[model samples]
Target chain A: MLEIKEIWKTFNAGTVNEKQALRGVSLTLNEGDFCTVIGGNGAGKSTMLNAVAGTWAVDQGTISIGGTDVTHLPEHKRAAFIGRVFQDPMMGTAPTMQIIENLALAARRGQRRGLRWGLAKAEKDRYQELLSGLGLGLEDRLTSKVGLLSGGQRQALTLLMASLKKPKLLLLDEHTAALDPKTAAKVLELSDKIVAENHLTTMMVTHNMKDAIQHGNRLIMMYDGRIVIDVSGEEKKKLTVPQLLELFSKVSGSDEADDKLLLS
Target chain B: MTVFLNALPGAVSQGLVWGIMAIGVYLTYKILDIADLTVDGSFCTGGAVFVMLFAGGANVWTAMLAALLAGMLAGLVSGLLNAACGIPAILCGILTQLGLYSVNMAIMDFKASVAINVTQADTLEKLLVSLRFVQGSVKGDFPLWRHPILVVGLFTACLIGVLYAFFGTELGSALRATGSNGNMARAQGINTDFCKVLGLMLSNGLVALSGALLCQYNGANEINVGRGAIVIGLAAVIIGDVLFSKLFRNFALKLLAVVIGAIIYYIVLQAVLAMGLNPNYLKLLSALVVAVFLSLPYWKGRYFAKPVKRGGAANA
Candidate 1:
């Protein structure tokens, strides 16, 4: 479960190019909740996820993850409770390292790193089993450098790495945006399967309105640094893109959606 | 042929020292993905610190340790500049290097140059003189060589072995990952800033250790000893990468290749000099060599690989 209280974040505060990324935004997620977030460009969706991840200090806010106050924690310190898959596939994994090594790193997350030999037999077997679950045949290529993998495969590997330690919260920030349509569909399916099987509390941000409706138990829409709509349970399951669009237009008081978000 | 053989031992010995420095450079440049120029300053810092400590009655081991610590401090300064002040990594390195010049001078007892007089008291010199005396009494008129290159060569070999083992460890793997992708490392709960500082410190410490040994071997330490050292180290790394592409997967082999590359570089320089080349043009020659090696990767990637842009034709 996660709670964000009165979060406010401003970039380049008081400067000529100042932008208030998040303004008095607050949200909550119960245990095992999978929430899909939809927003236009600069809607603070990514900023909200980053705030949860502690990418930077919020100007004012209190964030609690599973009853632990983590708003003041540094990015690395908060990483034990937060697993993040970035928009860029390259941003989530080390390219030069082998697949098994990357998994080994993820498995040791939050533990004291030492000078011992990496990837003992048990760890390697555990990683192979986990990779096999992705159905990507990465289990057979434990020694293959991650750079040699396709974008989808790399993203899948990154997903596995992020979830290996079973963090308290998983953050997926447009994780499938960089992949081809088919690959994206496959990855999205895998994301659902993984989150469901692991009983993870996840926040997935996507520009696609259909995806927002099609997945997750809860759906939220944001505009101008605030959550405009939060739908869940029966209402979220029955929602359609048209209905969501109509709600966005009515709530934001704008018939015209941002071109980027609409086109995307 | 005999001249080449006679030069081989010295070349190999010096190459090992340069190899250590090159590997140090590779740590920051290739692994950490930062263009760290602190090596240039730390190398001289090492030499100055070593000589000063040794002259102040410290043993060789103690002097070497001092040099390593001094180099680490130099690297820490660079890391702090980049992290605390938001300066660019390269500029941070340059600032630290510039600051180290004065610090190194101060460390050398405010001297511009300090020459370790190896005429009599040096361990190697004493051993060599004793051997020569024995040879003189027995063989009479047989030439005797001073300063056994074998000891230095063995020491360097052991150092490389230790480094190879260390780099294969989990901590080393994490350090390497930090260089490959800092953000990913951080997302995985690795404190990348700490890793950067640790990597830079380790890198410059090794470089300074080499410089310390180099000064003792050469019998003198000048303020400018580290000038253009970064380029030389880069040249070694690039050349080593080119010649031993197959060995790149192994850290130790890559390091060994760097040692060979340095020796080959020196041999080429010596050969050019033997062919009546100007010794003063060493820097220019080094730059050209580095340029050629650096461009090889791009050249191969562009021309020799399958053409991605043009239909299915192989570009080469």
Candidate 2:
């Protein structure tokens, strides 16, 4: 479970370009809760995830994961309990490393790194099995450089790596946005499967209204750095894109829907 | 031809020393994606520390260890300046280099320079003399080519071997990942700041080790020995990577290529000198070599299209 209390974040504060990215945004997720966050541009969706991930210290408030106060922990320290995937496919994995090597790093997260031979035989076999489950043929290419992988394959591997140890919270920041629609669907399906199998407490942010509505058990709409609507269970299941857009228009007091968000 | 062949071993010996420095440069520039200028000063710092320690009656091995430690300290300072203080890596290197100017002077006992007396019965010469049979078989009154070239070459080979083994380890893989993608490495719980510090320490330590070896081999430690070292190291790494593209994918082979690259670079310079070229143009030659080799990958990617493709496009 994760708890965020009155988290506030601002960029370039006290400058001409000052922007209040997150304005007293507060939300909580219970264990095994799979939440999809829908927002238009600058809705603090990514900022909220980053604030939890400890990418930067929030201007105000506390973040707790599994009852541990991680508000003051730095990014690397918080990494022991939190796993994150970024918007860019390239941002989630080391391109130059072999697939198995990258998995070994993920597997060994928070362990003391030493001058030992990399990836034991049993570990390699385990990684192969995991990769095979992705159905991406990556099991056969364990030794190939990850840079050569397609965007979908890389994102899938990143998702697997992020959840390899089943951290307390999993943060997905528009992880499939850069992929083709077909690939995106596959990745989303894979994401659902992984989250279900692991029973992961997940927060996935997306701009696509349909995806936001269809995938997760709980769906939340964010506007101006605040959660405007939080719907779940059968309520979330029956929600439509048009109804969600109408809700957003009513709450945010904006008649104009972002074209990109609507089109996507 | 005989003279060149006679100098071959010496060139190789010097090349191995430079190779070590080139590998150090590679760690920062290639592996860590950081442009570090600390190498020039660190190389001299290593030499100066070794010479000063040796002058103070330390054993050769102890002196070398001291030099390595000193270099690690210098690297740590640079890393701290970069990671802790939020200074850019290049600026950190420059600051360290400037600070080393005084530190190096102090290491030389405030003397402008220090000359290790080869005539003195040093451990290296004593070890060589003790192997009379090996020396006598090759040339009477000779000591099995126990010059700096042989010692430095053998030492470099061992160093490269150890580095190769280290880079193949799990920790090394993590460090490499840190270089390739800092954010992802962090997300995996890798302490990238610590990795950066450790990497720079290893890099500058190797550079300094090369410097110490050069001092012992050349029988002198000059304040200016580290001058132009960064350029030379860059030249060797680029040349090596260009010549050994296939080999460089492996960490060990990449290290070896850097050593070979340094030797080849020197051999070409020697050849040009032999052709009556002015020695003053050596810096220009070094620059041109680096530039040409660095551009090679781009040129191949951009201009080396197949004739079939060209013809097919024309027909279309």
Candidate 3:
């Protein structure tokens, strides 16, 4: 459902800080494919996802969602076909806005906002039902500001918002990294449930190798600026942390793996 | 004390007139989370547009509408500079404000100021609100209903009512979201740049409306009328937020708080002057007061923040 062709992005192009963030990287995901991405720091994992999200114009690339070329589309325009959950919990929702208001905003994605009342009476019941499904009791606090919710709750809410309208693609950029283990596990489980329920095409960036193996129908490992390992279906299901580290060591030509990636 | 009492009605009327401008400032400052310095020049743009059009024999409403449109244009320039050109927000506002000086001068035919000949009966009768109405009402020359206080009070109420409704709309909610979280807004498919421009237009439009009213009230539009206007706007918004944020939880009430804040600001100014302070030092005093109030929240965060054990699934 999503197509990316040989994308290249360089930061600070000519200056001393110049770094090629993405170098001829390319990938394609089929409809209903939930892909987990793993990479060490500066692996260009987030950079690749950002390239697909149109955070900035790629130096050279072509991206298409559902056969529509959106290579030059601005971030907000690309939003019509994409849902994104940022790493920072605060980045995914407006703190001062109410719970229902944030949901309403997500529900109206790809639609023109007009002079009509922001929260429709008919949608309130639907949102309440959806919130209740999360088991967070957010249904009772429709008018409460999202800022009052805890990190996990906010992350859960953001997950709901991202999949609210079932976009062509959903991008999760290490969404639960900030939370404690238990909460992160809960949010990850929630992500699985939501993706299955919605049959969403999702790309989830994760630091945990075990998680990269455990979840998703497909898994891809990024190293240095390109995808060096791609595993799917039965192969992905049988993948283990040790095997993945072995693959990484083989691909990176190093005896020592990235400490942060291994520890996480 | 008696002198202060005698000036109280005029002070209140002036406050009500400025209260409209404060509401405009509230839109950008509070709602949009932008300190748009465009008001410094747009205020006079409104006055200049209104007075020139009114002098040219346009209806008062038409003149006011022109003034509002002029102000919106000024806001558009600043919005484009900031959003499209990617200039810093403060710098964009400053650039627009600086450019507006010449625009205001040109609007007044290169003159520094323009005065309405209120001595003429037609002109006097045509004005919506004026200082003469304030004094005349006190001496019973005009009815209380015709007083500038009553006239401008109605204007403020209607303005707040309109704003309250607008902010509740889908477009308005998106605008608020843009201010609250631009990244979130964009992810949700909101054109945040468009929202920012619309907000600036709306904000400067109201500011111009207030300026036009001020010109009518004072019987003149001076080039320096808008000098320090942003400070006063900020003063009113901060004062309102400090005093009434807790008491007024509703959107409409928050706007009313801003108006009342302006009134309180004017009342305090009158009291200080009554105590023999020189009028020449008024701007300096206003600057200091606003500076202190602006620093208050930062001080609280830096000096008084409590350490809290934060994070985890338990809180969630």
lDDT tens readout by residue for model 2, B77-122: 9999988999999999999998898999988988878977666554
> Highest DockQ among the candidates is held by which one?
3
Q: What residue runs in model 3 are displaced by over 4 Å at the alpha carbon? A: A258-260, B304-316
lDDT of 1 by residue, A1-264 (tens): 899999999999889989999988989999999999999999999999999998899999899999999989999989999988999989999998889889888888887788887567778788888899999888999999898888899889989988999989999999999998989999999999989989999999998888888999999988889999999999999998878888888898877664546875
What is the C-alpha lDDT profile of model 1 across B253-316, one tens digit per residue?
A: 7777877787777777666766676889999999998888788779999889875575643211
TM-score of only chain B in every candidate structure: 0.87, 0.88, 0.96
Error of 3 at B144 (Å): 2.5
Clashing residue pairs, backbone N/CA/C < 3 A, model 3: none
lDDT of 3: 0.93
Q: How big is the positional error of residue A155 in model 3, measured in Å on the Cα after superposition? A: 0.7
DockQ of 3: 0.83
**Model 1 residue B182 CA deviation in Å:** 1.0
Cand. 2 Cα-lDDT: 0.85
Model 3 TM-score?
0.98
Clashing pairs in 1: none
